[model samples]
Target: MLRNAASLSVTVTALVLSAACSDDGREASASASQPTGVSTAPATDATGGTTDAAPTSSGTATSEPTTATSATATASTDDPVAPKFDIGGKDLGASTTGEGDGCKKVDFLFVIDNSASMEDNQAALIASFPGFIDAIKTTLSEVTDYHIMVVDSDADGRCEQPCVMDNDYQEFCSPKNFHACNANLTECDTTRGAGVIHPVGLYSSNKKCQVFGGNRYMLPEDPDLLATFACVAQVGTAGHPSERPMNGMQAAVSEALNAPDGCNAGFLRDDAILVITILTDDPHYEDEGTPAEWKASVVAAKNGDETAVVIAGLIPKPDLGCAGNGMTQGAHWQEFVDSWGDHGISGSICEPDYAPFFQQAVAVIDETCDNFNPPG
Candidate 1:
């Protein structure tokens, strides 16, 4: 009797497994009609399965209600509210056009360290400049007055110097004299001679443009923009080993604003916006007082109006990834950036691509301005 009972139990278990494995679909369909204590979501009928069929009193499948799958909507980054402008940290605010005279004046001062290590980075900046101009013209729109200038960070203001290869006194001298001098001399006035290339903002007045045989205005629409930018930006790969970009910038601006009928005359205006971009790989001292004092001078240069000036830094970031074998973040420069608050933006100089940084500068300028519209 016990053996018979055991054999019967085995047979029952086999029959249950066979029913569960069967593909008839009636069991699944019937289960759908019943509900357990736990709440569950409705199921949709799949292909090869019965469509919303219910279990009848006889346990046969019957027609039941069905639910259609609902489509979900996703937000796209192309939306108007999507963030568009970014520096290293936060997204810049969107720009709006306001009521004003049609003319919008923009002055750009680029203070670049022309040290031996800057050749490759300078090339990268020039390569990425077209995009920067386009971002200002196309994105910012109708800038009536736009002027650009370049200044070297060689701040020693030396006269004739020794060969840059021999001594490190390449300070404030032009790179064009590196071949003539046997040893780089510290006291030579670099602010003179071939090394002190004229600012591009004063292209018409700059004799170097004539020397280079370039046309009158090297504007964005000019055909010889590459040659023009190359000439102005080719400040040489032999500048002071301890470059002071802020000092160089101060000297450049001072020459432009102070000189009687200066070379950079008419470039800066009370109504126009002023922009300064400093590019370097290594940190240097702030010679003219603290960063705050220098910032005050920049603001004062723009008629004591902070709104008219914007300063951008494209130097080594405050990070291990940005500094290199012989370079580090410009600590005083970072302080200057902090002084400007929203009026300033920064990017990493170590980056091989400069388009993003250039674009960010334009965007920050746009945000700083009350309105983006140019004159009618």
Candidate 2:
């Protein structure tokens, strides 16, 4: 029910899900389409319901480059508009002195891979994760600070397919609804039938805030969000449990490049930038080790330099990824992802398009721009 997408360039969008009820008649919400003002955040009291953030390194940015990924905005239909900058560069003394200057701040981590043949990518992220927060609040209407997590890298605590584990995760087990019968009260109690998918939106960016979905309890992007979707069902969504393949965007870019040292955009905010997109058609298999130990687990989940911008869609390309049509080989795991594009890892092969692949990944977050601002 989700593959619908209006897509791109600074503005003009739409997302609709609205269906109510949920007590006996059975029906929750998915509702979308709303872009006016924008400022959301708040709704996390996690504690082994397991929010597990905690990674804080630091650096910075503003903006003003020209040819790296070629930045331009202003396309409006619902939201793309962004342009008119002081996005600074040459490290302009680490920029930002005025109203968040061209507002960089970003931290998005989605390391999804639900196994069990990924049950249609976990039902396309439970019906398009509410059009991915309605395409990021229709292009950042002040995302109140932005922080979204959606892990399932072979889950950790409960849920194998209607869970009830005791792996020492302590209390709050899963599976057995009829009102969790007694789950300390009632945050969720659907008998644990909806695993292979948790790690939803995790609100806190601006104006409206809330996240947690797979069946529904709270899913707001903006509509006066006061805080709700805190369902927190952390587990392996389905069953790929052979273990040893958890790269959940290298643990959400090491918590957005080690955030904390002054923390601005929730993580550490030296202009803040950390975006990992990892969708999956399954192919990073890595035989558990040895491609130099799986490229050293992707360079230790990219702890190298600039920090975060992982992008790995792998949807349904392979006709040589038709832009001009390109596909000599590579589609499964190893060979010709454009011949490994010299291993630097640029992207292209998109065709399945679930909302223009989240509006071209929110217009490729210019880590100070140099190439993909809109290039790929």
Candidate 3:
């Protein structure tokens, strides 16, 4: 159960009395008569005017006729209010201790949309990743083993047409040929749901990416994690315009892809907590299957243990002013994220800086890691 801080309100009432001087300049007696009993009826003042008795803190009426000089009411709320820690908010919660005896290995899968108009969003994600991983390392100190993989939303390989690879293994497309190609071009259909080691599509880096142990994913032992991630995560903008992020994510962790000779082999571990982060400006309408089914596939990858999975996304949230550039609201993605309850978090993809969003995600991930029970 999610815990929320309670709000407190205080009310203070002060009474003041004035003492008048006599004609002889001697100070008059400043003592005021006290009420003998609690008043249930209206009390009449010296001027014959009836005034309603004031209620004390205990909700009982007092017969005192004293004047109320001032009344102050103050209301204070805790730092993280109920809405702050809500399902899809930017401020989820504070950092957790992560001291529970749970799964210590974490697997992170990034499903990034490589469609047009995603250059800035991809750049923001890459720029914010270093700090995000650092915070994770500090907060989840026990988690020393990690597997990070990046995959594009295009499973059909729409950019393969009108584009060809040069002798140097560089992708050369019409009007953009002779330019630097940083992607690793492969059989179009083979990239379906495969971990992107060298992104080979339009708007890509056009450079080959080398991972430690020649694996498709990144491990903790990989030297210069930031540099390697920057290379592989630059899945350029020349993908299928109809983004299918859900399909990509589902296939990335599917049993076929994680087999011994599969593309994403050894990426998913039974004793590790799974964290899937989706970055896209498009909705999930282009993807196959419903949000419930997508979630089931992910949970199934973790041996049908839903508690061991966490989902976060930076998508178009119209309510949060995150809709623009032909980016409609992400109702399907929102439902998917909401399905995870506290283990899910969604942020506005239009946010100029993604640092805060990733920072807030750490709190949700930390809580999920605390209670994660690996399947024996």
Query: Whose lDDT is greatest here?
Result: 3
TM-score for candidate 2: 0.26
What lDDT would candidate 3 get against the real structure? 0.61
* lDDT tens readout by residue for model 2, 59-101: 0111112111212223444434322111112121111222223
Q: Better model by TM-score, 1 or 3?
A: 3
Candidate with more favorable, higher TM-score: 2 or 3: 3
Stretches of model 3 off by over 4 angstroms after superposition:
1-100, 161-184, 187-189, 324-328
Best by TM-score: 3
Clashes (backbone N, CA, C under 3 Å), per candidate, total: 18, 56, 6
Order of candidate numbers by lDDT, starting with the best:
3, 1, 2
Model 2 has an lDDT value of 0.29
Error of 1 at 135 (Å): 1.4
The runs of at least 3 residues in candidate 2 whose Cα sits more than 4 Å from the true structure, single-residue gaps closed, are 1-107, 111-149, 155-157, 162-221, 224-245, 248-274, 277-287, 290-370, 373-376
| Candidate order, TM-score descending | 3, 1, 2
- Please list all clashing residue pairs in model 3, or write none if there are none: 181-206, 182-205, 182-206, 182-207, 183-206, 183-207
Q: Encode model 3's per-residue lDDT on 1-376: one tens digit a residue.
A: 1222122111111122223222122233323322111111112212112222211111111222332111111232553221121122222353344444666799999999877556656776787687578767766767899999999897644445334554212432322453333234555224678988766555566566888877789998888898999988988765666788999999999999899988898999999999999987653368889888998999899888887888877765544333332332466776677677656666655543455566557766777787777666
Q: What is the lDDT of residue 29 in candidate 1?
A: 13
Worst 10 residues of 2 by lDDT: 55-64
Model 3 / residue 86 / CA error / Å: 22
**Positional deviation of residue 304's Cα in model 3 after best superposition, in angstroms:** 1.2
Model 3: worst 10 consecutive residues (lDDT sum): 54-63
